[model samples]
Target: MEGVFDLERVATFVAGYQSVMSLESAHLADTARRLWWKRMTDFWQLEFHYDRNDDSCDELYIADEALLHWWTERLDVVERTFAGSAQVPNSP
Candidate 1:
């Protein structure tokens, strides 16, 4: 699923598997949410400060926005794909 760009089908697959996995690990679901939100908010991709160039300053702070988005989306797919494994039991 990494040759050409396909968003609609991928999203559908992710959502579908996510629904199935909803019955599995609550921990992974929660973690997915956190990661999704973190990437959404902390999108400081390709940020560079030429004025303050130093060893401490990173040439590329974080990933490019598009790359980050793709990464986040992949996480969703992964979370859904493997959501059935190592599920935590629900409390009584």
Candidate 2:
């Protein structure tokens, strides 16, 4: 069966988003640095789980506070980056 989203791809997207935004300001750069580690931890902690009944590994059944906050912050950076780019491709 296929998953709804690819965790690795999500992680890569988040990293790329952070890298692009880090160029704007020192504070944003720090946030992006922290976010990279947070994303890695949150991905493994919240995205991977074990099924008790089946005794097998599985994707998470639900999202949690940490993951929610992580994604929200990630989206915020991505939005800001997109909004700021007037003509440039904004590649990072």
Best by TM-score: 1
- The lDDT for every candidate, in the order shown, is 0.49, 0.44
Query: What residue pairs are clashing in model 1?
Result: none
TM-score of each: 0.38, 0.28
Per residue, candidate 1 scores C-alpha lDDT tens digits across 1-92 of: 33222444444555677776554456655766676678567624323354444434453343345545565656655454334442222221
| Candidate 2: clashing pairs of residues | none
lDDT of 2 at 91: 27
Candidate 1 residues lying further than 4 Å off, grouped into runs, are 1-24, 43-64, 72-75, 81-92
Q: How do the residues 1-92 of candidate 2 rate in per-residue lDDT, one tens digit apiece?
A: 12122344444555577677654544554564566557545534333343234423333423434454544555545433333332222222
Instruction: Specify the poorest-scoring 10-residue window by lDDT in model 2.
Output: 83-92
